[model samples]
Target: MPSSSVTISSKCTILPDRNSPIIKTTLKLSVSDLPMLSCHYIQKGVLLSSPPLPPDSLIPLLKRSLAATLSFFPPLAGRLSTDAAGHVHIVCNDAGVEFVHAKAKHLFVASILAPGADVPSCFKEFFVFDNTLSYAGHHMPLAGVQVTELADGVFIGCTVNHSVTDGTSFWNFFNTFAEVCRGDKKISKSPHFSRDTVFNSPAVLPLPAGGPSATFAGDEPLRERIFHFSRESILKLKLKANRKRVNTEILGKESNDGWRAVNGANGKANGAVNRTDEISSFQSLCGQLWRSVTRARKLDGSKTTTFRMAVNCRHRLEPRLEPLYFGNAIQSIPTVASIGELLSRDLHWGADRLHQNVVAHDAATVRRGVQDWESNPRLFPLGNFDGASITMGSSPRFPMYDNDFGWGRPLAVRSGKANKFDGKISAFPGRDGGGSVDLEVVLAPETMAGLENDVEFMQYVS
Candidate 1:
């Protein structure tokens, strides 16, 4: 608690109305949901312009919209529980979500939007979900929303336990809520809670595998900073990576030709680059961040450093689940490389490495990963991942700006308050909704200080 701390202005719970509509049965969670049992809630917030009405008018609107939205997405209003053998499931008891109304005296949306300004601490309080709510307690609300009014803007904070849903499902709920707020009688896409089809029975399968590791185990103090990458910069990176790919391809061809000339035989290069070798904006940004963080930490060249990424498995599954399928449907892709290889290689080298991991996760690959996970059910490997690791959550491709709750689009989308994971980074679309990207990175103070002055990294980031 420092002078820059946020104070609570008001607090209250918003229950689903008696007729708000809810599912009566308890929905069994798949083994896929077990790994996140102890991880912090998935929290996120956005700053929007204050509606052109009395500040108090916003609360009633939010409450009404939430009640309506919950009718379509009832699991969020349910509570989590565990059975005798420690299996977790959601009880659709209509327990309801918590809502809060607050004001930050000196905080303005612009102050928060300003470049390099310290992230306001009130975001955590604005979103009212409790990270400490355990399955044993049986009183936890799976989702909550909070709105904090600043002098010139408002912050909308939301928290959803990772066990209940993934990013795609999380944003789907918000989009539906926004639809309700705008007076739409129905949501565009109804959520499909078909957990049965997505995951096999737990009796036959072992415990779930690949959940988040214990709450960010690093002991070092962490600092967070938001960095913006313009559409132009991102394009330049993709173009550079492509050019590197072509050059590497050409060099490999030449080396193969030379080898053939020396020996009377034809040999293929180590997978020559093709049109399929193209990279994505996410891979490009992660490449830049992983390299900069490695150099900033000044990790020893001989040690192993890993870049852990979150992969969405909705469409990657064989009989792909519907776009609206609820609950955890994500897998982890951890790419490991020695510091010497990561730092000494060109940006495209990192970009290509990350891109390959993403490309390899087709339907068959996803099935195998899940099968292995069910067979072994281990915590998603963080690589004993310490300062030398870079973990990524969220994606720039997610429809972040579309959650228009009757007001203008949000100025920025940010990860929620419980973001304590070491070397964690969240990606959101830039405000323009173009190809630009916004990265929210968390690192140790010294590493953050080094990253701030990292000339190569800052060159691409605005």
Candidate 2:
């Protein structure tokens, strides 16, 4: 590689004990690596500071914190290796961390590590690449945490394995490291890494495997797409659904006014929204969106829709389980729908059909199906999902904002690597349980343009 045309001090310092951890095992890595893919339209942000620790000392402090924290996180014993031995080096060079300022609706700064910083040469294969979006995500994470510097700024980016931990777990680790650095009293929440105790069976998804599509088709690199829906538009859609009658006891009867209006405008599919015993707020959203979107395009007569929500089966473990369990203990619950049903009238009442489809997996379904579904060589999921869209995501509820890690609430929570699947939607919290949902809608560029540019949708987006 050409010497960085952008020059900086070549002299770099390796933090203390950088070489201290002995590798119990290592995955052989190839220098030739696939380009890291970034289709996630959202970029979550957090402010990091190690006060009084100047640039020079920052490296040592971070490495020391990582090392000490590892004892508590034994799973990373051999998993977290460096590209170089001894130190997980830091480049103080100008190229090390860069920042850029731009004014949009508000002043914003973007930060990242330089593309080619001197990462440890001894690095293992796991940490160096992108997280695989293939169907059932991997339980093992490639802790390739890098502070990259982009043209505009410096930010921490990595391919965190979704199966190993959820966003809360990921940020939780960071907070603990910070506490360790400050020499705090103790890690507030004890982490669970005992695979046997923390994780239940099948360990993956697609129990029994086969059927549908084959092994995950190569993912089309993610394309940035946004869906514009308004707080009112959402409310309108709901209020018009099931008469003045609603589970409004939670959202209030006024909220369901839109459900009544929409049902009045287009009757038939309006009743289901009122029934609350089945599905969740998030799943209900998927079901509703699937119905609305399908109807929005049904004039063409040839399309289909499926609703899926990231379901946390952690509590579903046999005989019930504890509340503190950590790790990726969820799956995207797929709710099947035919285009005809989704697009037809009274989409609100029809929405419950989605609620009706979910069959939560028990131990039998998991052990016999999930494990075999993932490991079997002959089977995989289907790829030719024409006009099919999925909303695959776990809730961002578990106090992700509470993670101080000695820093503070993250300004944003981002998923750099999304599921390789197309037409995927991710959900995050809306300020303080007013029960808002945000989406990163991935779809073909043109189809998305049609929706985003639509006047009604623009109102929705705002």
Candidate 3:
């Protein structure tokens, strides 16, 4: 699709409904939120079948409901502020959010969901605030939504400041907006805005005069593709990862043979004593991806490869946060190993490594991570800095397909070209559900070609 194929019909700012009582206040940025200051806004959205009504009829309904939703999420309608100490905070002054209505009648849903098609470049144009960093929220809208009308469907794309919302909070706002559009009188889950649980003191961290620099290295051309693994395929991978193995002597010497322990405190694999614990489906799938991507890159055997998985800290903290806690509350836990060791190991070995790291990131470790950041705050080092790392964001467990705004459930979930770099992966629940998974993989062009042709990887892609 050419740029001329899509045209923006209208753009407006949406404020909270006047009927709702909204007080202007400031909300402190949590320890988890500070690192994202340099990151780009998260651009994600859903594709739905054509609505019963036309765009003119539906767009107004969406805008109206969005205003009501903003009443419940005051910070979203606010702007970022910096104090003399350079500490960033959200000022809830009803600054309003941007909403754009667009038309792309030439594009169809089939072209996007095609069996082995590269994600359409036109999808990026469906979102606003291209390349806008999160810190720009000081002047720009903290969030924006674009509704593009397709030939046979509609795409609702959203761009939100990463510092203010993680994948969890992003979906929470979307789900709530959908509910309001569906005429729900009561919010199923209200957001918790308290930052006390994130830290004790007013965790202050100053920033550079010009603000943090962008960490993404987009010099190399990249390819983005969505690989779907069916429910049965995921189950098969999990079963293989969990299959009982003979406690061979070789296993006992794993630690001596380049396999570093996941836990540094005890110099032993965390949760290794409970070998019977089942490997989660997520761990198994990610393990396969790590191995396949490594092979695709064709890196040197001695090169170190890292897989970073964003873990939700809300529940992992000592005092569990309210499930509805409404801000960034996630951290990336990296699992590292040499390419040779990772590729040579069995699926279970890699899966076990990922499982151990996740299990070891308990409350104490979470607190320690916070303290370390308080001591020295810096932006998240995103992108494949070493050309040998994969950072996985988003999750298959998020309620992605539930954004039914009077229209039918969404047919698929897609993302814009924000915060994308080589080795960046986003996971979404398969449209068919039932434990299925879809991985939106971004990689160097050559590596992607190799991955597409790799028999081992293609064999599991459904």
Candidate 4:
């Protein structure tokens, strides 16, 4: 569908509830938040099946509930403030958030959810703040929501500053908004807005006059597709990965016994492997994707490939953080291997590499990463600069389908073209609520074609 298929009807600002006691305050960007200053706003939305209420009533209800929701999330209603020293802080001054009402009568829900159909490019228009950077929050609304009424469904899209909230906080705010829309006066979980508990001393990193440069322009042409893996397929991959590990362990033990017999001694084996460790479903799926993508790209065998996984650090911290802790608290850890080794080895090897990297990012490792960043602040390089890297963001564990908003549950979830680059994959849970997973994969056009035709990858794709 072309962009002209969607037309905006009205645009307005939604402020916090006037009766709420919302005092203006300044929140200094924590170490986790500062890095995302240069990143684009996180744009995600849900596609709900046709609602019982018409647009006349639905739009007003969403707008009213959004105002009520903003009262609890003050920073979202605020603007970014840069101090004289170049430090950035969120100034909660009731600036309000942008809300847009649109109509896409030509589009239907079936066109979007059709099997083997490419995601409509015009979905980007469903969101506000099309290519705006996080720093733009200094002047523009820190967040925005666009509700585009489809012929048979409604698409509620949200654009939030990456510097202000991560996936956890993002969903939390959405869930609260839905709760208010459902006539709930009190939210189940209130956001914890204190950065003091996240770090001991806030690090000061002055920005240049021009602000941070964009690390990823996303100029390269790419193809985005959603690959759905059924529960059976996911279990198959997990079983294969675990079975490979067990067989490898047995082979290693036999080899060690043979070596001991030849040496006529009972010396300990070389490096002991963790026998009880099992590869998780996520890890196994990632491993398969990594190998398949590498093969599809058909890079040189000697070339090095890397998989970057974004790990949430809330529970990894020593003291641990409240589940409702707001803002960014994620670290991207990269697992690297040569193309030859990655393909020559079994799936367990790649999954184990990813599993080990995730396991090694403990509290101490997280602290060291923060300290290193404080020493030299830089924006996240949100792309495959090397042409052989895959960066995974978001998670299947997020409660994506829970945002009912007085309407029925979402039929599907989609994201806008924010921070998108080749090899950038976002995971969402299957709508059926099983062990299934959906990967929103972006790749070079040719590579995507190769992957679509590659039997090894398509065999498990449902």
Candidate 5:
């Protein structure tokens, strides 16, 4: 397809990573959907009890930081631009924030500034609608990020495109932002944006031109809408399932009684194994924990709905391959069954089904069938229906801790704040008490109330 040069700017404000061919591919595919996906970099600052720094004084530094960050990662200079025929393509330094616009007014952005600014409230308000680029993507940010400062507490945020980078990648740039602000040239790792392992199908058949358009119908059920579940609820459900046999009650023995009445109280482990040579011991443990949770659910269609975290294949798909793969490496693996269906079986039987889905996503299945899986809905059955729900989680096994910004550890840093969209789930560190993981499950107002009213959903109240 022929394309035109982008119109963001004449000068090359940003440059592409010379080593990344995948970056080239990402830029190419993003073109048709260009306007819909230009990335944004929002930098906010908090003033202490001293004084409020004028937005103008901040603008120069902000622009410099923005320019510096964009310099390190060249793709920021690129934009998905459209042509007269309405075909879109990528253009470097084509379009960017026209700060002169009213929407980009001197103080169009709200502040989390002390005495008056409320961080959470500001976030809620900003997130109530489509952000600056709302019309651009379904992944609208929290409407805006914030810079908060007060008597003792302090918090600053920057939220941007999920398509361009994962949560991990977002933090990568954020930490670097802090380093740059503090005048530290000591960056540990240079950014990687190569996607050698992620193969795009041909726009034609047999190949998966994996992108927004390639999304599968049946599998669409998984990503159509993802619902959040707190780790507390998961633990409660776990204990409820094992109430009869275990001494410690996550929900309570009575709760277990309710779970046990379903049917077959026992079954075989779903014959699945993930014993690859590269499987880290910790990943192996987490996998085992996931299997255990599935085992206890007893997905029988009436009580429990086993949940699974579908992983993006861009990173781990090929270890021998480069770390970066542009476009969506996101794959949906729903570890679930109809609510009524899950309640029919015992703990072990339910876990097996979940185990099967988990094991089914080995590198090869995803590599060999990525295109078919996303392109052929009837055959793969991914995007089959609308209003599907997914429960998401991450693996802490990868020696990946410390999202250390120059300020010290983010008193409490976490992602999964997806809002407006139905059935969205966000799980982070536990705010306080109990286990290592804390989950904040956000459902529709009705679904939340329903979960609250349901007998099976109220075990982990402590």
Candidate 6:
């Protein structure tokens, strides 16, 4: 089936208020910024207010509200540049963010939000993407916003350069824009732009010849599918993971004290795997997904599989960072195990492994990770990402659905096709605003087929 498509109606640049004093400032990029230098913008498609607005009126309101919001987020209005010494930095020169107005002729909110929906190719036209900006060393706008008019709704597509901010900061700018649209004069949180907080003691090392190209050019055929996990299903998974630990505790202590013993005890005599620091819902979900994917792929038992989770470093930093420190504050941590071990282990085993990895990242670990990046600024090896590896991104914890622009919450939130990479999984909060999880998985076609039919996998997803 041919995917539904969109048509571009108009394009313009949205700059900060011209009357505002423009400060000439440059934010020096550090080693931590090297991984995201490939001009890969994080794109999101949000279904706007239920009652769609007329194009003429909606466009002006969007433009006006965005301009007002940009005043608070100057970095989003900036551009990317490199000094004569070849060090990349963000020049806060108000280069302006690209704003495009589009019309998704036959597409509606339900069409785009439906599970297993294949978005049209032309949808990419809604956002700003220039290969030259990343590969050819040309200056690129830090942000882009494209609002598409649908028959019964609106699709607001946003793109932000990964070098400038991570998912948290992106949502920060987005929520603020929504606030402005709702006629709020002041935003709830102001972004902190002090890079000094995350400064590296040792200076960043110089880049290698040709300036570090981490972009992966591949021809492997892949497909993406979105699976929904409801609140009940997530609870079932959590229970499945915790049951093993609870059983072990009971058998060890020979006590049937129910939930009280599980909660009250520090997991000493019970022989429970430290329920005090038990596996989280996110960890349980990732573990199940990893195991399911591995089983579906039927990877060679001898091969080692890696699961890398993107960790938010705001709280990991010693003394903690300001809640609103704007920039890329995420790092990836990988856990490796043989396919045989992953398949042979119970669901709780994988959950425990993921939980341990999260527990390992302390303030010292975060500092060491920064120093390690300083020594070697190169991106993680793409060769290691075979069918056997899985990388998880975009935590459900991100407040993506909270952007209410005088309208109600988003009907659906989704990532652009540009984000579909092999062995990648993106998690978003379920529509109910409850504790459910929605997972978008991208994988080889054959693997996806197996996952679709896998009885064990289907049992936990409703």
Give the lowest summed-lDDT range of ten residues in model 5: 262-271
Model 6 poorest ten-residue lDDT run? 262-271
Candidate 5 vs candidate 6: which has greater lDDT? Answer: 6
Higher-lDDT candidate of 1 and 5: 1
Q: How far does residue 356 in candidate 5 sit from its true spot (Å)?
A: 2.8
Error of 6 at 352 (Å): 0.7
What is the C-alpha lDDT profile of model 3 across 1-462, one tens digit per residue?
Answer: 334267999999999886334466788788888889889999989898999987778999999999999999888899999887667889998989999999998888887677788888888888999888898999999999999998899999988999999888889899999899989999897888887785533667667776777888656688999999986566566666777443445334332322122111111112122233566667878888889899999999999999988877776666787767888887778999999999998888888888888877888898898888888877888988888999988877788898998878999899999989999998887898766778999999999998899887788899
Candidate 5 deviant stretches above 4 angstroms: 1-26, 30-63, 82-90, 94-121, 126-155, 204-308, 314-316, 319-321, 324-327, 346-352, 373-388, 391-404, 413-419, 431-435, 453-458
- Candidate 6 stretches with Cα past 4 Å from truth are 1-3, 18-22, 49-52, 116-125, 130-138, 199-202, 205-214, 244-275, 380-384
Question: Could you tell which candidate, 2 or 5, scores higher by TM-score?
Answer: 2
lDDT of 2: 0.39
Candidate 6, residue 166: CA error in Å?
Answer: 0.4
Model 4, range 68-162, lDDT digits (tens) per residue? 99989999999998887767889999889999999998887887677786777868889999888898899999999999998888999999999
lDDT of 3 at 336: 96
The residue pairs in collision within model 1 are 43-416
Tell me which residue pairs clash in candidate 6: none
lDDT of 6 by residue, 1-462 (tens): 334566778889888866334357867665555566654677876777544566787789989998888888887787666667666767777778889888776665565555555444444555656332232223556788898777678778888877677777888899888888888877898888777766433454465655555455544677777788876565556667766433445443422222221111110011122235666556777778889899998878999888877777776677777778778776777888899998998988887787787667667887888877776766544322566888777766667788888868888786775545678787777777566667877888898888888888888776
Backbone clashes counted, model 2: 60
What is the C-alpha local distance difference test score of candidate 4? Answer: 0.81
Error of 1 at 85 (Å): 4.6
Residue 374 displacement (Å), model 1? 1.9
Tens-place lDDT digits, model 2, residues 1-462: 222222222222222233322224232211000001111211233323323444456445555565566555433332322233321111111111111121111112322222212211111111223433311121222343443222332233334433234544555665565568667867776675333532333221222332122233445643443243344445544443433334447356554433232211011111122234333333345555565445444335555566655444444457443334445444334666567755555545554555454333444443444454335422223232665665555343434344343444444434443344555565554433343445555555455545444443344443
